[model samples]
Target: MKILDRYLLKTYLITFISVFVILFFIFILQTVWLFISELAGKDLDLMMVIKFLLFASPKLIPMVLPLTVLLSSIMTFGDLAENYEFAAMKSAGVSFQRTLRPLGVFILLLSLCSFFFANNVIPYAEYKFINFRKNIAQVKPALAIAEGQFSDIGSINIKVDKKSGDKGEFLTGVTIHKKSSLGEGAKTVIRSKKGHLISSEDSDLLQLVLMDGYYYEDITPKNYKDREKMPFAKAFFKKYNINIDLSKLNAKEGEDDEITNTHSMLKISDLKYTVDSLTTDYNKEVISVADNLYQRLGVTNYYQVDSINPKKPKTPELTSFLNNKDKFRVLDVASSDALSSKQNLEMNELNFRAKKKDINSHWYSIYEKFIVAYACIFMFFIGAPLGAIIRKGGLGLPIVFAMLIFISFHFLNTFGKKFSQESGITPFLGACLSSIILTPLAIYLTKVAINDNGGVNFDFITEPFRKISNFFLKFNKQQ
Candidate 1:
C-alpha cells in the first residue's frame, strides 16, 4: 500500500508540473502577442522585456493553477485506469478513497500555498507590472504613438503617416493639433511634410522638430460682416520646434507608494480597511446631506414644515398674495432656486453611490483570492473522478473536459463579479458563485466514480441530434 501511494503521488506531481509549465508558457506567449505592438520598435532591451513578463506572470498563476490541477488530475487517473492499475489496487482491497488519500493531502498543502501567493505576492507583482509599463512609455514617448494613428500626449494630438530609421527617429507626413485646455474658441493645426522626435537623458522634455510645415489659426470675427467673411491666418515655416514636458511622465525613484492606491495593489487586510472606512464615510455623507438640505429649506424634518410660532410670518402662499407680474417673478425665482438645489443634491448622491460601488468591488476582489485557492482542491476532485470513469488517457479527452469546465467556472465568476460591482448582488455571493456551483458537481463526480457508475455517455447526449438528422435525410430521400 505504501509503495502504491508513493508511485501514484510521484506520477501525479510529474504530470502536474509538466501541464503547468506548458500552460504557463502558452499564456505568457499570448500576453507577448497582445503587447507586442506597444513594446516592439521601442528599442527595448531583452532584460527589460524579461522583467516585464516576470512582473506580469504572478497575476496569471491564480488563473492557470486551477486549470493545471484539473488537466493533470484527469491525465493521471485516466492513465492509471486505462492501464488496469486501479483494478489491481481494488482487487487488493484498496478503495478509490484510500488511493486518493496521499494526493488529497498534497492538494490541501498546495491550496494553502496558492492562497498565500495570491494574498501576498500577486499584489506586489501587479503594482510592479503597472509601473513597469508606465516607465516603458516614458522611456520612449514615441512608443505611446502608434504608426498612422493619432495619439494624445498631454495637450497635443500627433499623427504620423510613417516612421523609419533604425531607432524610429525619422517620421513623414506629420499632423499636430494643439487643443486649448481653457474655454478658448478654436484649436491650432500644424501640418508638416516631415518630423522627428529628439530626446536627451539629461533633459526632462521631448522635442518634436518639423520641417516645411503650414500653421493655421482661426481668428474670431468682430462683427456680423466679419463673421460672413470667416477670417483666418495661415503661415508657412521652414522649421518648427515643440517641446513637451516629460517631468511628470518620467519615472521617479520612489513613486511606487503614490500608484499603490489602486485596488489590485492591496492585500486582504488593506481591502477590508478600505471597505470599512469607505462605508462609514459614505453613510456619514448621506446623513450630512439630509441634514444640510433640511436646514437650507427651513423644514423641521423630511415630512413637515415648522409652525412653532404663529406670528413668525406663516409661510405665505405666493399665488394668493401677489398679482400678475409680481407673482410671475416670485414663482420664477422659487422654481430656479429649487431646480438648482435638486441638481446639486442629485450630483452629490451620484458621486456617493459610485464611491460605495467601488468599495464593494474591492471587497469582492479580497474574497476572490481565497475562492480561487479552494478551486484547486475542488478541480482535483472533479477531474480525478471523471477521468477514472471515462478511462481515457493522455491529453485528448482530458484537455477538452478540463477546458469546458474551467471556461464555465471563469464565466460564472466574471459575470457574478460584474453584477456585484453594479450592486445587483452581494459581494459574498458574487465571489463564491463559481465555487458554489462546482462543489456539488465535484461531490457528484466523486460518488459516481466510487460507485463504479459511468458518468455521462456521449451516445446519450448525441442521440436526439442524431435522430433529427436521420429524419431530415429520410424526408429528403422521399422528396
Candidate 2:
C-alpha cells in the first residue's frame, strides 16, 4: 500500500473505533433506560443486571457500527479537507477517488465482517437474552403483577386495584379467579377488601392473606331434571388464607425452548428454511381450500351439465325435482354452505397472509444482514465526500450532518420494513429501499467532490431566480 492510502486507512480506522465505542455505550444506556422501570423492583442481582445488558448489547452492533462508520468517515475526511491536506494530495497528483480507495476497501471488508457477525452472533445473543429475561421474570414472579392488571400466577389470575407497603405486598380491592383443575365448568372466585402477599425465598409457597373477603364457588347439580336453578355457594370471611404453589416458578429454569423459533432468534439459513417451508404450506393450503370449496358446492365438472344436446339449455335441476318448500330448504342449505365456505376461505387467506408476513420478516432480517454491512460502505461514500465538499471538520458540523443522514436512513428502513410486513410491497424492495435511496446521494456527493474546484456551488439553486430578477431589471432599465 502507498503511504497516503496507509495514512488515510489508519486515520479512518482510529476514528471508527473511537466513535464506535461511544455510539455503542450510548445505545446501551438507551436500552437500559427503556427497561429500567420493569427491571428495577425485580430484586435481580447486580451481576444478573449486568449479564442482561451484556446479552442485549450485541443486538446494537448492526445499528451502532453503521452510524459510527458514517460519523468517523465524515470526521476523518472533513478534518483532512479542512486542513488543506486534500489540496496537498491533489497537488501531488492524488485524486479524491484515489484517496477514498483504501478506505473503501477497508469498509468493504468491515461490511463483510458485519454481515457474518449479524448472521451468527445476533441470533445467539437474541436467544440468550430472551431466556435471560424469562429467568429474571421467574426470579420474582410476584413482581410480574402490576396494579390495575390481572396477572396469572399458576392457576390463579390475581388483580389488585391498589398496592402499597415496603415491598408492595399490601394490596387493596383484590380479586382472584382460581381455575378448576378438573374437566368441569367449575371456578372459585374470591374478592377481598384488602390483601397481603407473603413469600419466603427458600419456600416454594406463597401465602395470600385476605381481610374482609367473600368467596364464591359454583356447584354442579347431581340430577339434570333438578338443574333449573343451578346451585352455588357464597360465603363471607373476615380473614381468608390461600396457599399458592410457587414450585413451578422456582423449577422453571428458562425452559422456553420454543422461543428459539422466533424470527429474531434464527440465523439466515434457518430463516430461509422456515420461509421455504411456510411458503410451501401456504401454497398447499390454498390448493386445499380451493378443492374443498369446489367439492362442497357439488360442482362435478365446471364445464359439463347433464344434457344430451351440447348447446341445449337444461332446466334448473333443483326446481325440477322439488316443491317450493324443498327448494327453499335446498336454497337455505346452499346459502349456509356458501357462508361456511366463504368463512373457511377467509380464514385460509388470513393464515396465508400471516405466513407471508412471517416470511417477509425472515427475509427482512436476512436483507438486514447485508443492509447494515453495506450501510457502512454507503455512509462512507456519503459522509467522506460531503465532509470534503463542506470543508468542515471536528464534531460539530459532522455530527449534525451524520445524525440527519442516519435519521433519514433509519426512517426509510423502518417505513420500508413496515410496508413489506403488511404485504404492501415485496421484501426485496422494502429491505433495500434505504440503500437504494442513499446510493444515489452518495454517488452525487462523490461526483461533486471529484469535480469540485474548491467547494460545491450553493448559489446554483438561486441562479434561476437571479436570472429572472436580472431579466426584470433589464426590462425596467429599457422602460
Candidate 3:
C-alpha cells in the first residue's frame, strides 16, 4: 500500500475501533438500565449480570456494526477533507474509485466478519443466552423459598416455615400448597418437622425427602358449604418422591435437534434445511392433497380431464325428462361437459392451497438473520456515500441522520419480515427488502460522488444563494 493509502486506512481503523467500543457500551448500558426494576430484589450477583452482558454482546454486534461504519466513515473522510488530503490526492492523478479502494477492502472484510458473526456466533449466543437464563432461574431453588412467600414451581407453591442446611441439603420446615387448572379444590397441606430436596436422575421430578410430618387433605364437595376437610394425626416418611412434573424444566436446550427447538432462534444452515423441507412437503401435498379431498367425497379422478367439448352438439340416446327430445339431448351433453369441468376445478383448488402454503411459509430463524446481514451491505454503501455528501461528521448531526436512515431501513425490513411471518407477504421479498430499496440509491449517489456533483456544492453554491437573496431583499426594502 502507498503511504497515503496506509495513512487513510490507519485513520479509518482507529475510528472504527473507537466508535464500535462507544456504540457497544451505549447499547448494553441502555439494555441493563431497563432491567433495573426487575433486578432490584433478585439474588442476582455480579458474575451473573456480567455473564448476561457478555452473552448479550453477540446480539448487539450486528446492530452496532452499521452504526460503527457510519460514524467511522464520516469521521475518517471528514478528516481527509478537513486536512485537504483528498484534494491533494485528487490533484496527484488518483481517481475517485482508487481513493475508495481502501474503504472497499475494509468494508468487504467487515461484511465477511459480520456474516460469520450473524450465522454461527450470534445464533449460538442466542441459544446459550436463553439456556443461561433458564439455568439461572433454576438455581438455589431452596433459597428461592422465602419466609411466607408462595414460591411457584410449575403449579405448586411451597412456603417453608424454617430451613436448616444441617445435612448438606435443602433442609426445611416445609408447608406445601399446590393447584392446577385441571384439578378440583383439593388442598393438600403438609407440615414436615424436617424436609429436603432431591432430584431424580434424568427426570424432572424432584423428590422431597420429608420426615415426621402432619398431612391435611382438604377436598371440596359438590356443594361449596358441604366441604370435606380431613386432618391426619401423624406421618413418618424416611424418603418419598414428590410426584411433581417440572413444566418449567421443559425449557428448550441449546440444541437444534428438532424443528420446534429452532422455531425462532435458528441459524442459516438450519433455516435452509427447514425451508427446503417445507418446500418439498408443500410440493408433495400439492400432489397428494387432492387425494385427501377425493377420499373425503369418494370422488375418484382416474385420469385428469383433457378437455370438455361444449362445441360438439351430440344428442343423447336416452331421453325421458323433456317432452321435446331435442331439449333432452342438449341437456345431457351439457351435463357431461359440466361434470368434467367441475372435476378439473377441484384439482386446481387443491393445487392452489398447496402452492400458497409453500409461498407463504415462515422463513426459518436463520433465514431472518441472513436477511438482516444482507441488509447491512446496502446500509454500508448508503452510509459511506451519505457521509461524503452531507460533510457533517460530528455525532450531533451525523448520528441523527445516520440513525434515521438506518432505523427506517431496519424497521422496513422488520415490518416486511413480520408480514411474511403472518403469510401476508412472500419470504423472498421480505428477505431482500433493503437491497431492493437501497441499491439503486447507492448507485446514484456513487455516480454523483464520482463525477464531483454529489447533490450539493460546497463553496460556490450556498454562499452565492445567500448573497443573491440578501441583494434582492435590500432592493425591495429601498423601493
Candidate 4:
C-alpha cells in the first residue's frame, strides 16, 4: 500500500520469481529423469509423460514455496544491504524496522498464501501427482513389470517369460500364484498356454487375456470324498483385467481415502466444520465412556464396601445351637448375593476399560489432524523469517534449508503422534511440537534482522559445542 512497501515488495517479488523458476526447472529435470528411469522398459508415449509432468508441477510448488520464500527474501534484503539502499533509507529518516515493515507484511501475505497452497491446492495437486504416477504405471506397466522378475501385483505374485513391443503384449510361460486368508493354502496357479495384455476404450484398465490354459486352484475343504484332478481346463479367452484399487493404494497419499479426494480449495469453513465434527464426536465419546465407567465403578465399589463393612453384631453371643445355625444360614445367603454382584462388577470393569480406550483413541485422532491443518500458519512463520535471515536467493540453498526444516517437522510430528497414541507423550503436545519448535526460531530471526544482525553461519557457532563434546569424550577415554 505504501510507496516503501511497494518498492521492497518489488525486490522480493523479482527475487521470488527468479528463484522459483530456476529451482522449479531443475526439479522438473530431475523428476523427468526419474520418470524416464521409472518408465525405462514401458511403452510410455511423449504425451503421457508430458501429462504426468504437468500434473506433477502443482504438487512441486507447495514443496518449493517455503524455500522460494527464504531464498528470495534473503537475496532481496542482502542486495538492498549490499547496494547501500538500506543505508540510504536509514539516512532519509526511515528506521531499519520501518523499512522492514512492508516486507514483513509481504512475508505475512506469502505465509497465508503458502497455507492456502499447502492445505487446499497442494493436497489436491499432490493427490493428483500420486495418481498421475499411478496412472502412468497402470498405462505402461511394461516398465512397471519386468521380464523374468517376480512382481507383486495385489495379493498375487506373477512372473512372465518375456514381453515384446511389436505385438504390444507379454508372452506365455507365465506362472501366477495367488494368496488368500486360508493359511496360504488357497492358491491359484495359472500356467497359460498364451497370454496378452489389452485395454478397452475409455477404461483405465488392462486385461491379461489368456488362451487355452489349464488353471490349477488349490481348494481348502472341510471334507473331500474325492479330489478333482485339475480345477479348471478350457480353450479360454480368459479376460483378466489389469486394474488397481487406486483409492486404496493411494489413500494415505492424500487427505483420506483418495475416493474422498477433494479440491476443498481455500475452504476454511469446510475444514472448520470437519474439525468441529471430529472434536464433538471425540468429546462425546469421552464423556459417554467416563460416565459409564463412573457408574459401573460406583456400583461395584458401593457393593464391595457394603460387603466389607458389614452391620455390627448386636452383642457377642455365647455358643448355642440356635445362634450357630442362624449364623451359618446368614453366611450362605450373603455368599450367593456377593458372588452374583462380583461377576457383574468384573464384566462392567472390562467393558469400561475397553470403552475408555476407544475414547482416548478417538480424541487423539482429532488432535493430530487438527494440528496438521494448523501447521500451515506455523510453517509460514518459520519459512518466511528463515528466508529473510538466510538471504540466499537462489533455489539451491533455500530449497535445501526449507526442506530440512519441513521434513524435520514432518518426521517429528509423525513420530510424536505415534508415541502419543501409546501415551508416551500427550497428544496435544505432540501435535503442536512443530509449531513450538519453529515459533521461537522465527522470533529469534526477526529480532536478529531488526537489530541489523542478519544471517549467521550457524555451522561455525555449532561446531564448538560438537567439538567440545567430542574432545571431552576422547580425553576421558585416554585418561
- TM per candidate comes to 0.79, 0.73, 0.68, 0.58
Tens digits of per-residue lDDT, candidate 1, 1-479, equal 58888999999999999999999999999888867755675567788889989998998998899999999999999999999999999999999998889999999999999999999899999988887766654456566666778876667878898888755778899998888767573368999999988876656688889999999977767686787776778999999999887644433347543354477788999989988888888777776776566577655433333222222334544467667899888779879878988998899978877887788788898989999789999999999998898887898777878898999999999999888987889988999999999999999999988988675575664467679889999999999
Q: List candidate 4 stretches off by more than 4 Å.
A: 1-7, 22-40, 60-62, 126-148, 161-173, 179-188, 196-207, 216-432, 452-459, 462-479
Q: Write the per-residue lDDT of candidate 2 for residues 228-254, one digit (tens) a residue.
A: 886789999999998877644322335
- Which candidate's TM-score is highest? 1
Best by lDDT: 1
Clashes of each: 0, 0, 0, 3
lDDT of each: 0.82, 0.81, 0.64, 0.59
* TM-score, cand. 2 vs. native: 0.73
lDDT of model 2, residue 396: 69
Clashing pairs in 4: 70-387, 74-391, 206-242
Runs of candidate 3 with Cα error greater than 4 angstroms are: 30-52, 82-88, 91-96, 134-148, 161-173, 182-193, 211-218, 223-240, 243-260, 263-267, 278-373, 454-479
Model 4, residue 364: C-alpha shift (Å): 10
What TM-score does candidate 3 get on C-alpha atoms?
Answer: 0.68
| Ranked candidates, highest TM-score first | 1, 2, 3, 4
lDDT of 4 by residue, 1-479 (tens): 87888887787778778878987998788777755545455556778767777766765664466556655665566566657676788789886568667766666666666555556665466566766655554555444556787766655667778777654466666767776765654367766756676644345555666665666766545456434543443333354443433223222233353234232222445545654665566556555544554355444333322232433434445446568779888779768767866886687567655444443444444454445445544554555445445544444455566666767876776777666646667767766777688777767776776666644565664467678889999999999
- Each prediction's RMSD to truth: 6.5, 9.4, 9.7, 9.9
- Model 1 scores worst on lDDT over the 10 consecutive residues at 302-311
